[model samples]
Target: MTNITFKNNPITLLGEQVTVGSVAPDFSVLANDLSVRTLADYEGKKKLISVVPSIDTGVCDQQTRKFNEEASKIENAVVLTISNDLPFAQSRWCAASGLDNVVTLSDHKDLSFGMNYGVVIEEMRLLARSVFVLNENNEVVYVEYVNEGTDHPNYDKAIEALKSI
Candidate 1:
Protein backbone atom coordinates (compact mmCIF):
# COMPACT_ATOMS: atom_id res chain seq x y z
CA MET A 1 0.00 0.00 0.00
CA THR A 2 1.09 3.57 -0.70
CA ASN A 3 1.04 6.20 2.02
CA ILE A 4 -0.24 9.62 0.94
CA THR A 5 -1.89 12.50 2.67
CA PHE A 6 -5.08 14.44 1.99
CA LYS A 7 -4.85 18.08 2.97
CA ASN A 8 -1.72 17.22 4.99
CA ASN A 9 -3.43 14.43 6.90
CA PRO A 10 -2.03 10.98 6.32
CA ILE A 11 -4.01 8.37 4.38
CA THR A 12 -3.21 4.92 3.09
CA LEU A 13 -3.96 3.82 -0.44
CA LEU A 14 -5.26 0.33 -1.21
CA GLY A 15 -2.92 -1.01 -3.90
CA GLU A 16 0.57 -0.89 -5.29
CA GLN A 17 1.26 2.30 -7.20
CA VAL A 18 2.04 2.12 -10.88
CA THR A 19 5.65 3.13 -11.55
CA VAL A 20 7.49 4.44 -14.54
CA GLY A 21 8.70 1.60 -16.82
CA SER A 22 5.96 -0.68 -15.49
CA VAL A 23 2.98 -1.81 -17.51
CA ALA A 24 -0.17 0.08 -16.55
CA PRO A 25 -2.98 -1.94 -15.04
CA ASP A 26 -5.96 -2.51 -17.30
CA PHE A 27 -9.26 -0.99 -16.21
CA SER A 28 -12.85 -0.94 -17.45
CA VAL A 29 -14.07 2.61 -16.82
CA LEU A 30 -17.46 4.07 -17.66
CA ALA A 31 -17.48 6.35 -20.66
CA ASN A 32 -19.82 9.28 -21.21
CA ASP A 33 -22.16 7.00 -23.15
CA LEU A 34 -22.24 4.62 -20.15
CA SER A 35 -20.23 2.14 -22.16
CA VAL A 36 -17.29 0.29 -20.70
CA ARG A 37 -13.88 1.29 -21.98
CA THR A 38 -10.68 -0.58 -21.33
CA LEU A 39 -6.99 0.18 -21.85
CA ALA A 40 -7.10 -1.58 -25.19
CA ASP A 41 -9.60 0.98 -26.46
CA TYR A 42 -6.73 3.52 -26.57
CA GLU A 43 -4.20 1.37 -28.35
CA GLY A 44 -1.63 3.12 -30.53
CA LYS A 45 -2.13 6.44 -28.78
CA LYS A 46 -0.18 8.15 -26.04
CA LYS A 47 -2.42 8.14 -22.96
CA LEU A 48 -2.60 10.78 -20.23
CA ILE A 49 -4.53 9.72 -17.17
CA SER A 50 -5.39 12.84 -15.17
CA VAL A 51 -6.71 11.19 -12.04
CA VAL A 52 -8.37 13.66 -9.72
CA PRO A 53 -10.63 13.59 -6.68
CA SER A 54 -13.63 15.04 -8.53
CA ILE A 55 -14.52 17.50 -11.24
CA ASP A 56 -16.90 19.25 -8.86
CA THR A 57 -13.92 20.82 -7.12
CA GLY A 58 -12.42 24.01 -8.51
CA VAL A 59 -8.91 22.64 -8.90
CA CYS A 60 -10.04 19.47 -10.58
CA ASP A 61 -12.24 21.37 -13.00
CA GLN A 62 -9.37 23.67 -13.89
CA GLN A 63 -7.04 20.75 -14.48
CA THR A 64 -9.51 19.11 -16.82
CA ARG A 65 -9.93 22.30 -18.82
CA LYS A 66 -6.21 22.94 -19.00
CA PHE A 67 -5.56 19.42 -20.22
CA ASN A 68 -8.40 19.62 -22.66
CA GLU A 69 -6.82 22.68 -24.23
CA GLU A 70 -3.42 21.03 -24.34
CA ALA A 71 -4.84 17.88 -25.86
CA SER A 72 -5.57 19.56 -29.17
CA LYS A 73 -1.93 20.53 -29.62
CA ILE A 74 -0.60 17.14 -28.70
CA GLU A 75 -0.86 14.81 -31.68
CA ASN A 76 -1.99 11.20 -31.43
CA ALA A 77 -2.70 11.48 -27.72
CA VAL A 78 -5.72 10.71 -25.57
CA VAL A 79 -6.21 12.73 -22.39
CA LEU A 80 -8.51 10.98 -19.94
CA THR A 81 -9.82 12.92 -16.95
CA ILE A 82 -10.68 10.21 -14.45
CA SER A 83 -12.56 10.52 -11.20
CA ASN A 84 -15.08 8.75 -8.97
CA ASP A 85 -17.93 10.88 -10.34
CA LEU A 86 -20.79 9.29 -12.24
CA PRO A 87 -20.70 9.23 -16.02
CA PHE A 88 -23.68 11.55 -16.34
CA ALA A 89 -22.17 14.20 -14.10
CA GLN A 90 -18.85 13.99 -15.90
CA SER A 91 -20.52 14.43 -19.25
CA ARG A 92 -22.50 17.39 -18.02
CA TRP A 93 -19.42 19.12 -16.65
CA CYS A 94 -17.48 18.57 -19.84
CA ALA A 95 -20.28 19.84 -22.02
CA ALA A 96 -20.83 22.90 -19.86
CA SER A 97 -17.15 23.72 -19.79
CA GLY A 98 -16.65 23.09 -23.49
CA LEU A 99 -14.06 20.45 -22.79
CA ASP A 100 -14.13 18.70 -26.14
CA ASN A 101 -10.57 17.45 -26.39
CA VAL A 102 -10.34 15.47 -23.18
CA VAL A 103 -12.45 12.43 -22.27
CA THR A 104 -13.81 12.28 -18.73
CA LEU A 105 -14.04 8.70 -17.48
CA SER A 106 -15.81 7.48 -14.38
CA ASP A 107 -14.81 4.74 -11.95
CA HIS A 108 -18.02 4.69 -9.91
CA LYS A 109 -19.02 1.10 -10.66
CA ASP A 110 -16.13 -1.25 -9.89
CA LEU A 111 -13.67 1.30 -8.38
CA SER A 112 -10.87 -0.77 -9.88
CA PHE A 113 -9.27 2.15 -11.65
CA GLY A 114 -8.39 3.88 -8.41
CA MET A 115 -7.37 0.68 -6.63
CA ASN A 116 -5.24 -0.50 -9.50
CA TYR A 117 -3.62 2.90 -9.88
CA GLY A 118 -3.17 3.26 -6.09
CA VAL A 119 -4.91 6.61 -6.00
CA VAL A 120 -8.06 5.71 -4.04
CA ILE A 121 -8.64 7.65 -0.85
CA GLU A 122 -9.18 5.07 1.93
CA GLU A 123 -11.82 6.85 3.98
CA MET A 124 -13.31 9.12 1.35
CA ARG A 125 -14.99 8.00 -1.85
CA LEU A 126 -12.53 9.93 -3.98
CA LEU A 127 -9.23 9.55 -5.77
CA ALA A 128 -5.91 11.19 -4.96
CA ARG A 129 -4.60 13.80 -7.35
CA SER A 130 -2.24 11.97 -9.67
CA VAL A 131 -1.06 11.82 -13.26
CA PHE A 132 0.22 8.94 -15.33
CA VAL A 133 1.60 9.17 -18.84
CA LEU A 134 1.69 6.08 -20.98
CA ASN A 135 3.33 5.38 -24.29
CA GLU A 136 1.56 3.89 -27.29
CA ASN A 137 2.82 0.44 -26.27
CA ASN A 138 0.99 0.78 -22.92
CA GLU A 139 4.12 1.27 -20.86
CA VAL A 140 4.18 3.90 -18.14
CA VAL A 141 6.56 6.71 -19.04
CA TYR A 142 5.85 9.31 -16.38
CA VAL A 143 4.02 9.56 -13.05
CA GLU A 144 3.20 12.28 -10.54
CA TYR A 145 1.59 11.85 -7.14
CA VAL A 146 0.60 15.26 -5.83
CA ASN A 147 1.84 15.52 -2.26
CA GLU A 148 -0.57 18.21 -1.21
CA GLY A 149 -4.10 17.24 -2.10
CA THR A 150 -5.44 20.73 -2.60
CA ASP A 151 -2.73 22.18 -4.80
CA HIS A 152 -2.72 22.10 -8.58
CA PRO A 153 -0.28 19.83 -10.40
CA ASN A 154 2.73 20.85 -12.49
CA TYR A 155 1.15 20.70 -15.91
CA ASP A 156 4.25 22.06 -17.61
CA LYS A 157 6.33 19.06 -16.53
CA ALA A 158 3.64 16.59 -17.52
CA ILE A 159 3.26 18.21 -20.93
CA GLU A 160 7.00 18.15 -21.44
CA ALA A 161 7.10 14.44 -20.70
CA LEU A 162 4.19 13.78 -23.04
CA LYS A 163 5.85 15.73 -25.79
CA SER A 164 8.96 13.58 -25.49
CA ILE A 165 7.04 10.38 -26.24
Candidate 2:
Protein backbone atom coordinates (compact mmCIF):
# COMPACT_ATOMS: atom_id res chain seq x y z
CA MET A 1 0.00 0.00 0.00
CA THR A 2 1.05 3.55 -0.70
CA ASN A 3 0.09 6.66 1.22
CA ILE A 4 -0.82 9.96 -0.37
CA THR A 5 -2.77 12.94 0.80
CA PHE A 6 -5.56 14.79 -0.90
CA LYS A 7 -6.73 18.13 0.48
CA ASN A 8 -4.57 17.61 3.53
CA ASN A 9 -6.19 14.29 4.34
CA PRO A 10 -4.30 11.04 4.20
CA ILE A 11 -5.33 8.44 1.67
CA THR A 12 -4.08 4.93 1.11
CA LEU A 13 -3.77 2.95 -2.08
CA LEU A 14 -3.44 -0.79 -2.61
CA GLY A 15 -0.75 -1.99 -5.02
CA GLU A 16 2.89 -2.66 -5.61
CA GLN A 17 4.58 0.28 -7.26
CA VAL A 18 6.84 0.85 -10.23
CA THR A 19 9.81 2.84 -9.01
CA VAL A 20 12.89 4.35 -10.58
CA GLY A 21 15.23 1.65 -11.94
CA SER A 22 12.34 -0.79 -11.80
CA VAL A 23 11.10 -2.51 -14.90
CA ALA A 24 7.77 -1.05 -15.93
CA PRO A 25 4.77 -3.31 -15.54
CA ASP A 26 3.15 -4.17 -18.82
CA PHE A 27 -0.44 -3.01 -19.07
CA SER A 28 -3.23 -3.26 -21.62
CA VAL A 29 -4.75 0.22 -21.82
CA LEU A 30 -7.50 1.44 -24.12
CA ALA A 31 -6.35 3.61 -26.95
CA ASN A 32 -8.19 6.37 -28.76
CA ASP A 33 -9.49 3.77 -31.17
CA LEU A 34 -10.74 1.59 -28.31
CA SER A 35 -8.07 -1.01 -29.13
CA VAL A 36 -5.98 -2.54 -26.41
CA ARG A 37 -2.41 -1.24 -26.39
CA THR A 38 0.27 -2.83 -24.30
CA LEU A 39 3.68 -1.59 -23.30
CA ALA A 40 5.14 -3.60 -26.17
CA ASP A 41 3.27 -1.39 -28.60
CA TYR A 42 5.87 1.28 -27.84
CA GLU A 43 8.85 -1.03 -28.21
CA GLY A 44 12.05 0.47 -29.59
CA LYS A 45 11.06 3.95 -28.54
CA LYS A 46 11.66 6.11 -25.52
CA LYS A 47 8.47 6.48 -23.51
CA LEU A 48 7.03 9.09 -21.18
CA ILE A 49 4.07 8.01 -19.13
CA SER A 50 2.09 11.00 -17.89
CA VAL A 51 -0.24 9.70 -15.23
CA VAL A 52 -2.95 12.08 -14.09
CA PRO A 53 -6.05 11.94 -11.94
CA SER A 54 -8.37 12.93 -14.73
CA ILE A 55 -8.05 14.81 -18.01
CA ASP A 56 -11.03 16.97 -17.18
CA THR A 57 -9.17 18.86 -14.47
CA GLY A 58 -7.02 21.91 -15.08
CA VAL A 59 -3.79 20.48 -13.84
CA CYS A 60 -4.23 17.27 -15.79
CA ASP A 61 -5.08 19.18 -18.93
CA GLN A 62 -2.02 21.37 -18.47
CA GLN A 63 0.22 18.37 -17.99
CA THR A 64 -1.08 16.69 -21.11
CA ARG A 65 -0.67 19.83 -23.20
CA LYS A 66 2.81 20.46 -21.91
CA PHE A 67 3.88 16.94 -22.71
CA ASN A 68 2.24 17.06 -26.09
CA GLU A 69 4.15 20.21 -26.91
CA GLU A 70 7.43 18.81 -25.70
CA ALA A 71 6.91 15.47 -27.42
CA SER A 72 7.16 17.03 -30.85
CA LYS A 73 10.77 18.01 -30.32
CA ILE A 74 11.92 14.75 -28.78
CA GLU A 75 13.11 12.31 -31.37
CA ASN A 76 12.14 8.63 -31.06
CA ALA A 77 10.11 9.36 -27.93
CA VAL A 78 6.41 8.65 -27.38
CA VAL A 79 4.57 10.56 -24.69
CA LEU A 80 1.56 8.72 -23.35
CA THR A 81 -0.96 10.72 -21.31
CA ILE A 82 -2.74 8.19 -19.14
CA SER A 83 -5.87 8.63 -17.05
CA ASN A 84 -9.09 6.91 -16.02
CA ASP A 85 -11.13 8.89 -18.50
CA LEU A 86 -12.87 7.08 -21.34
CA PRO A 87 -11.20 6.89 -24.73
CA PHE A 88 -13.94 9.00 -26.27
CA ALA A 89 -13.34 11.76 -23.75
CA GLN A 90 -9.62 11.53 -24.32
CA SER A 91 -10.11 11.80 -28.06
CA ARG A 92 -12.32 14.82 -27.65
CA TRP A 93 -9.89 16.57 -25.35
CA CYS A 94 -6.93 15.90 -27.60
CA ALA A 95 -8.79 17.08 -30.66
CA ALA A 96 -10.06 20.13 -28.85
CA SER A 97 -6.63 21.05 -27.61
CA GLY A 98 -4.82 20.20 -30.85
CA LEU A 99 -2.72 17.69 -28.99
CA ASP A 100 -1.56 15.58 -31.89
CA ASN A 101 1.86 14.50 -30.71
CA VAL A 102 0.88 12.82 -27.47
CA VAL A 103 -0.93 9.49 -27.22
CA THR A 104 -3.68 9.45 -24.61
CA LEU A 105 -4.40 6.03 -23.12
CA SER A 106 -7.44 5.25 -21.01
CA ASP A 107 -7.40 2.90 -18.01
CA HIS A 108 -11.11 2.74 -17.36
CA LYS A 109 -11.77 -0.94 -17.94
CA ASP A 110 -9.78 -2.89 -15.36
CA LEU A 111 -7.77 -0.05 -13.76
CA SER A 112 -4.77 -2.32 -13.87
CA PHE A 113 -2.58 0.40 -15.27
CA GLY A 114 -3.08 2.55 -12.18
CA MET A 115 -2.91 -0.37 -9.80
CA ASN A 116 0.29 -1.73 -11.27
CA TYR A 117 1.87 1.68 -11.56
CA GLY A 118 0.89 2.60 -7.99
CA VAL A 119 -0.86 5.80 -8.88
CA VAL A 120 -4.45 4.83 -8.18
CA ILE A 121 -6.15 6.97 -5.56
CA GLU A 122 -8.25 4.24 -3.97
CA GLU A 123 -10.53 6.58 -2.10
CA MET A 124 -11.26 8.89 -4.99
CA ARG A 125 -11.22 6.37 -7.81
CA LEU A 126 -8.60 8.50 -9.53
CA LEU A 127 -4.90 8.35 -10.36
CA ALA A 128 -2.14 10.25 -8.66
CA ARG A 129 -0.35 12.83 -10.74
CA SER A 130 2.97 11.33 -11.77
CA VAL A 131 5.40 10.82 -14.59
CA PHE A 132 7.67 7.97 -15.57
CA VAL A 133 10.23 7.87 -18.33
CA LEU A 134 11.39 4.59 -19.75
CA ASN A 135 13.99 3.41 -22.19
CA GLU A 136 13.43 1.12 -25.14
CA ASN A 137 13.71 -1.91 -22.88
CA ASN A 138 10.88 -0.62 -20.68
CA GLU A 139 13.16 0.06 -17.75
CA VAL A 140 12.16 3.10 -15.82
CA VAL A 141 14.90 5.75 -15.98
CA TYR A 142 13.11 8.61 -14.29
CA VAL A 143 10.11 8.99 -12.05
CA GLU A 144 8.23 11.89 -10.46
CA TYR A 145 5.30 11.50 -8.11
CA VAL A 146 3.93 14.97 -7.55
CA ASN A 147 3.22 15.19 -3.85
CA GLU A 148 0.53 17.76 -4.16
CA GLY A 149 -2.55 16.56 -5.90
CA THR A 150 -3.14 19.85 -7.68
CA ASP A 151 0.39 20.67 -8.65
CA HIS A 152 2.09 20.15 -12.00
CA PRO A 153 5.31 18.19 -12.32
CA ASN A 154 8.74 19.44 -13.20
CA TYR A 155 8.62 18.86 -16.91
CA ASP A 156 12.03 20.36 -17.60
CA LYS A 157 13.73 17.90 -15.30
CA ALA A 158 11.75 15.02 -16.74
CA ILE A 159 12.72 16.00 -20.27
CA GLU A 160 16.33 16.37 -19.25
CA ALA A 161 16.28 12.97 -17.63
CA LEU A 162 14.85 11.44 -20.78
CA LYS A 163 17.52 13.17 -22.83
CA SER A 164 20.21 11.69 -20.61
CA ILE A 165 18.99 8.17 -21.34
Best by TM-score: 1
Clashes per candidate (backbone, < 3 Å): 0, 0
> What would the per-residue lDDT of candidate 1 be over residues 1-165, giving only the tens digit for each residue?
345788889876766689999999999899999999999999999988999898989999999888768866889998999999999999889788865666999998988899899888888878899999999998999999988778788899888888899
lDDT of each: 0.87, 0.86
Model 1 residue pairs with clashes: none
Candidate 2 regions exceeding 4 Å error are 1-3
Clashing pairs in 2: none
Compared with the true structure, model 2 gives a TM-score of 0.94
Q: What is the TM-score (0 to 1) of candidate 1?
A: 0.95
Q: After superposition, how far is residue 106 of candidate 2 from its true place, in Å?
A: 0.6
* Model 2 score (lDDT): 0.86
